[model samples]
Target: MKKNKMSFETSFWTGLAEGNPFREVDAFFAFAYLDYYKQNLSEMVIYSRKTKVYKQDNPSDVFVLYTAFNFFLKVCYGLQKKSKKWKVKDSLCCETVFHLTSLTQEEYENPFIVFQKAFGENTLEEFELFLCQIVELSLSPHAGDPDAELTTPYIHLIKMLDAGELIRERGVEKIRKTDQMDPVA
Candidate 1:
């Protein structure tokens, strides 16, 4: 994934200034996923910095990010419920960053609906690959789902990462500064 010439915020500002926040989340998700996740980063510090201070205050934007991220997770891994209490987990926030870059929703929910089916019976690592695949597919010009057919790859790459994956490489030291806090159920 190559870095886009412009940040998602560039396009977002124009749309937001015009009162169109519909596809911002979708575009942001695409942009961030490509730049931050797919391509290797400089020590992962760049993305790490972008994350810690970021917050999603808008309900609509929250809905979009969570819906998309959760959809991706579901598609790749399997159907799972999300904890209502938010945490600073990279697995969660990485996807959220994708949504934060832009604003707006696609009119049809076919992509999301199609992915929901593919999510069944997948392991976490396998789900990661599926996620990579989904981003690749979505970026392609020929990509789209009218009927939203769900197909199975039958590949299992879901290596459930421990705290290491949750914290991210950059946050490793930061974790030592804090104590474990029970997650809100």
Candidate 2:
């Protein structure tokens, strides 16, 4: 008998549909996007200099952005899974995040418009800041454990997304700063 291996995409879709709490889909997408970006870092640097024209020429950038949006969807799913004690407003926020994930790439390209249509401008701004913070943490040097080198970034990303404030408040930032300032004695 032969065993079949499930592809990452298949597993991802299945996890989404099944509402699996441990799948860590956001982490997977984040790591994938980061790997892709690292591979094309030079191109991105060049493209940054020509932002207006870059979008017109670089289709992959759009795909990468869409991938990031997918991560956001996964984050919402995780939030929903863990929202058992959440207030009505928190539940509604989770629903809004999940709904935003349904928007097409064309729709998400103008995120302000989509957000305004679904949530409000304040939510849009906050969401954007959240994404920016996630990306900043993803690119940091000590985002993951040294023993699990390949999965370090993904681990950090998953923790950040799951906890929401892990990157901002008493999470990775605090740990990293403390580790830097004081030696483990």
lDDT of 1 by residue, 57-91 (tens): 33243223333433334322321211112222233
Task: Find the candidate with the highest TM-score and give its number.
Answer: 2
Q: Which segments of candidate 2 are over 4 A away from where they belong?
A: 1-16, 24-27, 30-33, 37-52, 55-57, 73-125, 128-185
What's the lDDT for all of these models?
A: 0.30, 0.35
lDDT of 1 at 136: 35
Once fitted onto the true fold, the runs of candidate 1 whose alpha carbons sit more than 4 angstroms away are: 1-67, 70-120, 142-150, 153-185
TM-score of 2: 0.27
- In model 1, what lDDT does residue 178 have? 52
Q: What are the per-residue Cα lDDT tens digits for candidate 2 across 1-185? A: 99543222323332443333234443444345533533343232233333233345545554455355445534433443333323211221223444333344433232222322323223433444434443333333333222322232322233333333221122111112223466669
Clashes of 1: 21
TM-score of every candidate = 0.20, 0.27
